[model samples]
Target: NAGVTQTPKFRILKIGQSMTLQCTQDMNHNYMYWYRQDPGMGLKLIYYSVGAGITDKGEVPNGYNVSRSTTEDFPLRLELAAPSQTSVYFCASRPRDNEQFFGPGTRLTVL
Candidate 1:
């Protein structure tokens, strides 16, 4: 089964360009999350959803927003992006807790 998928593999955005990072899982997990990792840094949670229609913000949700409309998809929206938002974004999920599987990642570069 495809655990989680994110695309496009890389992106370049101008100072204010907007984009949506798509995430989907075939595992039917109840929990999904969005996280960003700067170079040589730990992953910081941006948003999480326990189940469909139940989304919540996390540690670093400032420049991002997420929605959980179905058990399979949780997409991240970046509006009016800034240079500070340049980082690798990952989509993850857990059937339980504390142990999550991540997507390959979306490398975003904002200039």
Candidate 2:
């Protein structure tokens, strides 16, 4: 089964432009999360959802938003993207905290 999938593996965006990072999972997990990873920094949570119809903002929710309208899809929307938002975005899921699986990652750049 596919664990998690993210689209547009690489992208270059002009400052102020917006895009959506798509994510989907077939694991049937209830916990899904969005995280951003800088060059050498650890993962920083942006948003998460416990299940369909239930969502919460995470540590770095600024400039980003998410919606979980279905059990398998959790897409992240970037509004007015900025240089500060240039980072690798990852979508992950876990049956619990002990086991989390990450997507391939989406590389975004703002110029």
Candidate 3:
């Protein structure tokens, strides 16, 4: 099973443009998270869901949103893209007492 997967491995968006980054997992994990990695920086949490219908803003959620409607999927939505948002986005999932599994990641460039 695909532990976790993300679509559009790479994307370019103009300033103010919006896009949705898709994430899915096959591990039946109840926890899902979105994180961004900037050059020379560690991953920063953007959003997360503990389970279906329960989502919360993370450390860097100002320009993004997310919803968890099922156990396998959590999509991150960028409302208004900006240069500051250009980074590699990673999706991760974990079951209780298990290590988190991460997606390959989506590289976003805002011009």
Ranking of all predicted structures according to lDDT, beginning with the best and ending with the worst = 3, 2, 1
Candidate 1 C-alpha lDDT tens digits along 17-111: 99999999998889999999997889999999999999999999998888888999999999999999999999998897578889999999999
* Steric clashes per prediction: 0, 0, 0
RMSD of each: 1.1, 1.0, 0.6
Question: Candidate 2: minimum summed lDDT over ten consecutive residues — where?
Answer: 92-101
Question: What lDDT score goes with residue 47 in model 1?
Answer: 97
lDDT computed for candidate 1: 0.93
**Model 2, 13: alpha-carbon shift in Å?**
0.6
Point out where model 2 deviates above 4 Å: none
Tell me each candidate's TM-score: 0.95, 0.96, 0.98
Count of clashes in candidate 2 = 0
lDDT of 2 by residue, 1-67 (tens): 9789999899999999999999999989889999999978999999999999999999999999899
Candidates 2 and 3 compared by TM-score, better number? 3
